[model samples]
Target chain A: MSGGPAGDSAIVVSDLRKSYRGRPAVAGIDLVIPRGEVFSLLGPNGAGKTTTVEILEGHRRRDSGDVRVLGVDPALGRAAWKARIGIVLQRSDDLTQAGALTVRDWARAMAACFPNSRDPDEVIELVGLADRRNARAAHLSGGQRRRLDVALGIIGRPELLFLDEPTTGFDPEARRRFWDLIADLARSGTTILLTTHYLEEAEHLADRVAVIVDGRIMEVGPPQTLGGRATAAATVRWLSPDGPRSVQTCTPAALVTDLAARFGQDVPGLAVERPSLEEVYLRMIGAPA
Target chain B: MNAAATLVRAPALLAVTRARARVEFLVFIREWISVVFTFIFPVLLLIILGSIFHGQRLPGDVDLAQYFVAGMIGAGLFGVSFQNVAIAIPIERDIGTLKRLAGTPMPRSAYFLGKMLMVAFVALAQNVLLLGIGSAFFGLDLPDTVGRWITYLWVIVLGIASCTMLGIAASGFVRNGRTAPAIMSPIAIVLQFISGVYFVFATLPNWMQTVAAIFPLKWIAQGMRSVFLPDGYQAQEPAGSWELDRVALVLAAWCVLAFLVAVRTFRWRARTDD
Candidate 1:
């Protein structure tokens, strides 16, 4: 609201740093996310994903570095600037204050705060909460409560949305539904910054993904090609007369042909497998991979 | 220019306050603990105390029941405005409700205004309940003159303003929801006792009376007594007169002082957050 909007990018950070006491949380990080992009900050717990997002959301202040979210420094975000962005904080069992308001009622109240907001009912339906419209927030399941959170976030029709581990406790079915809702929002051209530890989730929803570990960005690229997954060596395995044999090679096709030639026919129990995103992410984080 | 700025914000501010008041009222009604403590407990005490001290007369020939009716009104105002705001807000902070609202574009003033609006409604209902019960069963007399009614109205208004601000300021000291009642209730109960809401002010020890004089509750209760007690009863007061000016002065001062403290101490995030 104070400065002109940054061109082309929704978020830009240069050496963004934050620390708690004497220890660093988001140690120096740099990122640039283009407008309308669904970018995910994927990392394990304590890896600075939430800290970085919270800084971007203006919920926390940075100790140092230049950061721009929607072209305004979040530290100086005012009401007019806040109205243009939406935030979905990490799930906590702190809805005791939600009281008896039904989902529709809550959505309508939140919508009233924004200057240009989507119709509450439409946003409810968009998040698949139409059937649970009249349920009090206390009565909704964890997934439904999260849907309400998301519904409230988008009710403002934010040009930029921050989803901090939006589907942490969701079951598989609920998570799939939540992902679809996010994909719909993205297709509508809303830029989404999601933080999650779920490899499949980032792969499913993010246009580009950044793998973070210990307050640093380990890799930033498309999930399919993260850590060179597209070009990484494939492992070829087969049951030979010696029992079992395997080879890690960039040319899996050539390896398979030679194995077939040795057997003079079909190779027994032969399998060629590329590293999944999970493996690549685990390896990037220095976890057991 | 200042008026123009207010004009631009007035509509949205009023709308948000009204919406918040509606939700706050619903939440207050649903929480039976808050309702019973704020509205029901003081009236119940008045009845129980009035009956126990039935037929007893104060120095001014004021019946014990009539004396308590005035005190309970002040006590009920404190319970509804001060205790509720102090304890409820910390719980909101503890549970992240305040944190969530901070990110919204809702004007901060609207939040406090919404709370005051809700408190006004609840305090009015509390007064009707206390007065209706007092007159119906305890033979308490209602004020008969317009002047007395005016005094009654200002006492209630000033009492609520001062207490609500103090409550907001006190909320900052609460660390979490679990510990809030433990910390808030003792302070509220102690203030009521020392302020002459629970006993004869003239009978209180010298140190206690001196201490009570420094707080708003004593002035609020004394103001209520001036409105309800018969004419010429001021001889029983420590000052031997209805010091209406001093009463108004003390309460208005507390409103300003507590407001500054509240603004300085209010925390939007829960303790767990950085």
Candidate 2:
């Protein structure tokens, strides 16, 4: 009935646990997401990102422990909290059979869920779907379908949003556009929880990132420096008579300077780089070398 | 906010309910196949059956024209309340639409209430159409009292609620489109036959009369009969006591049990884990 409960934290889950019969999906996890920050939860398949999101969304019940979203216990949100949160599902719920309820109709429909929902056209524009506002939901291309999902998600003008694999089927350009839409929302002080298999999405959008594996949080930090990435080491690559070669070391700056001198000029095909977000993320998830 | 404050949020809830109602209505119109099946198909069945059995009186001297009127009326209500609700829901679930909505901040109860409201409206629409047919073709008499009208209205409502629950209950048990009809049709058809929607139960054998009495559909049809037919019709019919309150009470009980089953059995995910 109110906007949110009294608390500084946007979302707080303390030892939250949920099980399907006897097997735990979210096996005792504690998380505190600050308001107005874009946080990404990175995980592989069956790694509990969806279960945790579902629990936080109040769609599924937690068998034990305290879970709070937008300050109120989600288990007891009672539609007040639901009005302030938006969710962009991984799969499109395109009513191809339910004809011609256009973008405007959808926005109007979702707006009714909240007392103070956003204007439909503004939401359409926000999600880069203005051009297709009149088109039917089922007629949209895959990338455009993702945009519609974002449109419906933001139509409520939610304070917090949960995007589960939002750009999973997007092409490169659409993915970049979606990143901009998310960044714009973050700039407007809407806190977001993003879950994705695309490490690049996490690297690009997250203000803070958490790695989830085996139903556990393995690491949490900024994307650039997660999993000891900032100080873990760097790789220096250069063309060699023995073919292109590379070495990992802590002192990449010093190594690059030495390589510049040894090559007697700018090193041929030479590049000095820290590990990419994907590389670090893959390694953190324990993918094979 | 306190419970008092939540109660005061009625205006917002009304808006949400209205919006959902509009969407559902649009869905119905767009789903022309459902419209044809729910509305036109029943009308056709009535005409065909009426024509086939014309001139020859029912064994119990059952009014075939009035039977067509009553049965179609009940069938129309069942279509929206039980038939469409059951089928549309599973398809919606199989496609993950309900799970998608679960992610939104929409109150879970609002979803059902909105649906109930929508079905009630659609049933009203359906009843009026059938009422016109009944009056025009069968020399039907209007409800003798406002009380009878209210009684009939609520019976239709209860019938819908029971049907909706059956749909919801059935939706929980299946995960795909293939099994939806398989699960729904047999029970629905059986209810149609025994509940006096297609035939007056008095004409049936004694064993059937006893067996049909146990179901919600029987209560609904009996309740509707209490409204549409006069007291003399009951004496002639020789089936079902003319206890309007008893029928209402029986339906209300089934309604509560169905509501519980709907809530307890509801599954949002793709499949039953078991």
Who wins the TM-score comparison? 1
* Candidate 2, A1-90: lDDT as tens digits: 113443767888778776776877777787778888899989998888988887787766778888878878777876556767888866
**Residue ranges of candidate 1 with Cα displaced over 4 Å:** A1-5, A237-247, A253-271, B1-11
Across B177-248, the per-residue lDDT of candidate 2 in tens digits comes to 657777776777887887777776777777776787777777777777677766567765553356777777
DockQ of prediction 2: 0.37
- By lDDT, the best candidate is 1
What is residue A214's positional error in candidate 1, in angstroms? 1.1
How do all models score by TM-score? 0.93, 0.86
For residues A49-133, what per-residue lDDT tens digits would candidate 1 score against the true structure? Answer: 9899988988888999999988889988777777779999995454535566788878877776766778999998888889989
User: Lowest-lDDT window of 10 residues in candidate 1 chain B?
Assistant: B1-10
lDDT of model 2, residue B92 = 75
Question: What is the iRMS for every candidate structure?
Answer: 3.8, 3.3
lDDT of 1 by residue, B1-274 (tens): 2556444533387788887887788788877889998888998898899788768888788987888888889988988999899889988887777777788777888788878988999999989988898888776888999998999999999989899999899888778878888888888899899998879888899999999999888888999889889877789888898799999999999999999999999888876577
- lDDT, candidate 1, residue B79? 88
Q: How many Å off is the CA of A180 in candidate 2?
A: 1.2
